[model samples]
Target: MKKQLATALAALVMAPAMSATSVDLGYKAYTSDTKSDNGGAYDQPFVKLTHFNKADWGTLLAYVKLENPGEVKDAQHGKDGKLTVKSLLIVDKQIGDTSYNFWGQNFLVSNRTVMEDNLYLGVTTNRKYGALFINAGVGLNYSAAHFDPTGASFDGISGYAAVINARYPFSAMGLKHSLSVNYEGQIDRDEDHMSTLGYDSYGHQIITTLKTSMTESFYTKLHMTHFDSWGAAPNDGIEYGVAVGFTF
Candidate 1:
C-alpha cells in the first residue's frame, strides 16, 4: 500500500511539473508544544521543505520536516533525527457551469522514523462562494504503526475518514491575505485496531492558518493546530507557530 501510494505521488509530482500552472518551494521553521498522554512533551523546533503545485488536473502539496535539527541526541520526546512527511493531492472535475465540482482527494502522512503511516482517500464535493472555497468528503482510512521498546506492530484498514477544507482570500492592510481551515476525522474505527494503536475511535485534527503575502514572491503565515486522540499516542494538544517563505 505504501509503495502504491508512493508511485501515485511520484506521478503527480512529475506529470504536473511539465505544465504546472504555478509552483512554490520554500523553507519553513516552526516550534510545537505537542504532548503525549504519558506526559511527554515535544516542544521542539522543526525545519521543513515545503512544496506546492497546481495544474489543470489537480493540486499537490507536500511538507517534509526534520525534528530537532539542532539537537545532537534525542530529546524528551525522542524525536531527534526523525523525519515526517505530509502530503495531499486533489483532482477536480467541474460540475457544468455551476460553482460546484467533484473531487478525488488523497492525504498521506508518513513518520518513518516512528514506523507510522496513515492514508486517507475521499470523493469530495468542492464549492466556491465568492472568495470562499470549501471542499468536503468522506472516505476510508488505513493506518500502520510499530511501537518501539515494546516492538509491537499493526497494519490494516482502520476505519472511515472525513475531510474538510476551506479557504477565503482577501486584501488587508494593502497586502494579499488568506485564511484557511482544515479538518480530518477518523470515524467508525475498528475497536481492536484503535486499542492496539493507542488511539481513539474518533480521532481528529483541526488546523487553521492565516497567511499574507509580504510581496509578490514573499509570504508569511501564522498557524494553529488542535488534535485529540490522534497520532501515535492517543494524545491531545494545541500548537501554534509562524512561518515565512518565498514563492516562484
Candidate 2:
C-alpha cells in the first residue's frame, strides 16, 4: 500500500510530462514579455497537445518548436511522424533564440529569426548507455532577424544546444534521479572564428531539471533556461509542476 501510494504521488508530480494523448493547459506569472496591454490577465496560458504511436514511444524525442505570435493564436496538429500543420514554428521563433543549431543532431530546437523563410535541419544520436546524446545542425533563417526592431520584436537566431544527462535508480524511494547540462552556441563566421566555426556563441545559459520524486507516479518538476547575447542581458525563468505521471 505504501509503495502504491508513493507511485501515485510521483505520478501526480509528473502529470505535465506524460500527456501524449490528452490536451493540457497552464499559465505563468513572471515573464518579462507578458503583455500587459493585451488584457487584465496576468497568466499566459500553457496549452498543448500530445499524440504518439508505438513507433515513437520509447525514444526520447524533443521538438524544434517555432512560433509566429500575431500570425497565429497557437495550434499544432499531427497524426504521426507527419504533422498535419502547425504554427509552433512561429512560436518557437518568437520566444527568442541565442544558440546555434548543431551539425549532427537536434533534440529540442527553436530558432525564430536566424535566416528567415528557411528553417534549419539537424540530426542526433545517443550513446549506448543513454547517458550521453550529441546533437548538431545548421540554421539559415529565411529572413534576417532584428530583435525588438520597431518595438514589434521579431526574435531570430540560430544556435545548437547539447545536453548530457545521467540517471540512476534511487533504491530508497524507487525513483530515478537525473542530472544534465545543456550547452549551446552559434556558428562563428569569420577567419578568426574558423578554428571555432563549430563553436563560440553569444551566451545565455542556465541549469534546468525535473526532480523530487516521492512516488513512482508523482514528482515535482522544475524548469529554468537562460542564454546570453552581446546586447541582450541573459534572461531566465522557472516553471513548476506537481502532478501524477509515469513512463509506460
Candidate 3:
C-alpha cells in the first residue's frame, strides 16, 4: 500500500541524520493578528519544542528526534489550544562502506501541529535536499506558517517558509547572533480548498535575524524577520517580533 511504501522510504531517508554524539532542544512562542479564518490552521499560534541528536556506531549510526508541542490562539477562542507529541529517527553510514564519514535525514509527524498526517524532512552532516546546507557545522532552520482571515474551507489563508542558519558561542560578549535570509509565502482560501477555482489571496516574506544575546543562565534574547506581507496582505498583519526564551 501507499502508506507502507511511504513509511519504508521515510526510514531509509532518515538513516544519516541520527549519526551524531550530541543533541539540542528548542522552544518558541509567538503571536500575530491576521485578517480572516480560512477554516484551516492559520495564525492559530502556539508553543512548541523540537529536538535532534546524533549517535555513533563504528560502521553504522542511529539518529534520534523528538518533539513536544503546544499552541494557543486568537481566532476561534474555544477551539484555541491544540497539543501534540511526536518521535523521529534516522541512520547514517559511509558512502562506500570504506571511509568513516556519512550523511542522512529524519522523518517527523504530529497530529496537533499537522493536519491529515504529513511527513517533514531534515538532513544531517549539513546536507539538505542534496544541497550543501551548512555554514559552520550548525544546521539549517526553516518553517512554513499560514494565517487565514476568510472563514472558508481550505482555500483562504496559508503561509510557507525556508531558512538555513548557524550559530556559535561568542565568549567575549556572552552573545550569539544567528543570521539568515528566508523566503516565505502566504496563501488565502475559498469555500472549497481542494477546488479548481481556489484563488483567494496570498503574500510573501523575506527576513533576517539581526542579533541574539545570552544575559544569564536563565535567559536569552533574539530578534528575527521584519516581514511585511507582499502584494495583497495574505493573512492579516505582522512583520516581526522580539523573542526572549528561558530554560531550567
Candidate 4:
C-alpha cells in the first residue's frame, strides 16, 4: 500500500511538470508545539516547495516540506527530521450548475514523516462573495499510521473529512495583502483505532494567515494555527510562526 501510494504521489508531482505550472521555493522557520511521546517540540527551520497548475480539466496544488533541516538526532524523526507532502487536485468541470456551482471531484493526499498517510475523495464547491473566495469539500477518509514509540498502529478506513478554505485579497498601505482561513476536520473516526493511536474520535485543525507582498516576487506571512484533539497526545494548543518566501 505504501509503495502504491508513493507511486501515485510521484505521478501527481510529475503531472504538473508536463504542463505549465507555477512554482515557489523558499525557506520557513516555524515553531510547532505538536508532539508525541517520542517527538518533542519542533523549533527549527525548513524548506518549502509549492506547485500550482490550472488547466481546462481542473486545478492541482501541491507542496513539500523538508522539516528540521539540520537538527540534532531525536527519537521521533531521527537525524534530519522528516519530510511532509500534501496535494489536492480539484476537478472543476461544472456538473449541471445550479447557481451553487457544483464542481467535480476532490482528491486529497497527505503524507507525513512516513508515519501517517491519509487519502480523501469527494466533491467540492467554490463560491465567491465580493472579495472573499471560498472552497469547500466533504469526503471519505482512509488513514494509515504507525507510531513507533508506543508500537501502536492503524490501517483502515478512518472516517469522514471536510475542508474549508477562504481567502480575501486586498490592497493596503501600497502593498498587496491577503487573509486566509483554512479549516480541516475529521469526524466519526473509528474510536477503537484512534484511541490506540492516542487520538480522539474527532480531530480539527484551523489555520489563519495574513500575508503581505513586499514585492512582486517576495512576500511575508504571519500564521497562527489551532489544534484540537489532533496530532499526538496533548495536542490542544496554538502554534504561531512567520515566514518569508519568494514566488516564481
Over 4 Å off, model 1: 1-40, 70-74, 77-113
lDDT of 2 at 134: 37
Write down the lDDT of every candidate, Cα atoms only: 0.65, 0.32, 0.35, 0.64
Worst 10 residues of 3 by lDDT: 135-144
lDDT string, candidate 1, 13-129, tens digits: 577633322233323322343443423335445555656665444555555555445443344545444444555555554456544445555555455334556666656677789
Instruction: State the displacement of the C-alpha of residue 19, model 4, in Å, after optimal TM-score superposition.
Output: 9.0
Q: Give the winner by TM-score: 2 or 3.
A: 2
Q: Which residue pairs in model 4 clash with each other?
A: none
Off by over 4 Å in 4: 1-39, 72-114, 232-234
For every model shown, what is its TM-score relative to the native structure?
A: 0.74, 0.40, 0.38, 0.74
Model 3 error, position 153 (Å)? 16
Judge candidate 3 at residue 11 and give its lDDT: 66
Q: How many angstroms is residue 209 displaced in model 4 relative to the true structure, after the best TM-score fit?
A: 0.9
Candidate 3 on 154-216: residue-level lDDT in tens?
Answer: 322222222233433333455655444544343442234323213333434555544354543
| CA error at residue 234 for candidate 1, angstroms | 2.3
Which runs in model 2 stand beyond 4 Å of their true positions? Answer: 1-118, 130-172, 189-201, 212-219, 230-248
Lowest lDDT 10-residue stretch of candidate 2: 87-96
- lDDT by residue for model 2 (1-248), tens: 99999998765445433333323333333344422221211222343343422221122223222222233233222211111112222111111133322322222222231112223344333333444443323343211233222222223334433333333333345666554445444443232221211113433344454455555544444444443331112222332322233332
Candidate 4 per-residue C-alpha lDDT over 1-248 given as tens digits, one digit per residue, 9 for 90 to 100: 99999998777655653343333333333234454422434444555666666543355566656544444323345544544444444454434543233343333322243266667766777789999999888888777776665767777888888889899999999999999999988888886557655677888889999989898878888888777776532356666677777877
TM-score of 2: 0.40
